[model samples]
Target: MVRIAYDPTPYHFNHGVLELPDIVARLGYEYMQLTPHPEFGPFHRMPKADDELVAALKKRAADAGVKIVALQPVQRISWPEEPQREAAVRNFKRVIEITAQLGVDTINTEFSGRPERSEDSEAGFYRSMEELIPVAEKEGVRINIDPHPDDFVEDGLEAWRVIRGLNSKQVGFVYVGSHSFHMGNQAATLLPQVGDRLGAVFAADTYDHHRSNGLRYITNPPGNSVRVHQHQEIGNGDVDWNELFDTLGKIGYLDREDAVIVSNVFGENEDAEGSALRQLDKIRELISGAAR
Candidate 1:
């Protein structure tokens, strides 16, 4: 059944790997999605988590009564150059090995490629997948790709197309709630469209710019200025919670172990643990109401 998972990204910036599981357990969450931290080595490049480190982290999670159900490694899997693409493939293989060791069957990430070079990036992405899909199948790990604002394939429908092109059950789509506007402001439409291929949901609320023309935020040039959103708690933003859950239910996504719903809110000066607990309660309420 739909276990609510906490993503330790806000904590990763302030805490180390060994110290995170206890915090998560204290917040009353048994499942988590582990994010990359410097202490654990860069997930994009050659990750340095050896056997010893992996075992230690696994033990820590067990001691705290937490199950790491998913691992998120933020890497540019669609780099245009052959050498860089090969390196990304190697790094992803290492991540899959670690996922197996931690007893996690899923890895969630973005189809990160440069927006300026979409065609070349997509070619590189398929090439990398050609090499990595076999490793994922061998390790019994499933990869869930999401559409990020700056990624080459940012549209929800297009992301689904990429997953379909892969044509492997081991690969699926993750819908990030905060990216609804960037993905075409049609979460209600897209959720049902993804249907069974929807592997996970990064649950958070986001403002709908269509109603409010106010500038959300600004970033320096050469960076992703088109992206403007926040990962806020439910009800703080414009995401229709009831509609989202209703769509999920319509697609038969409720009460399933494999259909994960993760609370992943990121911001500065926010109480990470407190916010996580609040988000969990909100999600549980939504699920309870949906069941009725």
Candidate 2:
């Protein structure tokens, strides 16, 4: 069975971390992918969590009957600078320690490669992984890295290569539906290419830009240079949900013991709770249909 998880990215800005479990459970979701928060350092660049905070968060989730299946620590580890890179590695080590304490086994993140210096960034990524991989193994945690649009290793094939290079079962790839355009055109083909390294997935939709010729939509001047995409409700965008689910079934993702299918829709909408519940229903229906 494919365990469907709800990610609280939309609520990260408005809701307190302690309140997430209740919201997730109320939406009828059994699992959650905890995002970074200012109070808990968002688990991004070294959380502000000590033993007390970690214990509190874990207890809160347990009390609400929501299992924290994964934690997303959004940090830039591909910095070419030496000191900053070392600090990122250290921060990730702390994140892994927190993951172990919370009894969660997975950490999802972007490769976060530097756009300007691709080669240096790739080297930096490998160097950081060398230090962090052993720590992950020791703590019994899996690292699932994805190919974000502007990251150095943005290509799906390249991301898989990096995961394979790590040469550890604890490392794997995440297929973000919101990044399908940037990942590649053939979702059916690309997904299976990751093969057994496919550990988790970010279930959301994005506006298709394959035919736009780079003239799709403009955010604003002076915005972050990276190309951004939406994490809208599944059927609201161009992601082929039927095809995605069918492909997943063909790959036996639903049967994998460690597979995580997360509903990660984020926007400035008012009814986040309603939106999440709706997405959960859609995901469940698709998974069930695929099984049949």
Best by lDDT: 2
| Cα lDDT of model 2 by residue, 90-207, tens digit | 8899999999999999999888777778889889988989899999999999999988888887778767887788778888999999998887747688878887788888888888
CA lDDT of each candidate? 0.84, 0.85
Cα RMSDs, all models:
2.1, 2.1
Query: What lDDT score is found at residue 159 in candidate 2?
Result: 75
Candidate 2 residue 75 C-alpha distance from true site, Å: 1.7
lDDT by residue (1-292, candidate 1, tens digit) is: 7888988878876788888889889989989889887777576777777899889999999999999889889777898777777778888888989999888899999888888888999999898898889998999999999988888888899888988898888898998989887788676788777778899998988887656354455446534447678888888888888888878877788866688899988863367777888899999988877732
Q: Candidate 2's error at 110, in angstroms?
A: 1.0
Q: Which ten residues in a row have the lowest lDDT in candidate 2?
A: 215-224
- Regions of model 2 farther than 4 Å from truth: 218-226
Task: Specify the poorest-scoring 10-residue window by lDDT in model 1.
Answer: 214-223
TM-score of each: 0.94, 0.94
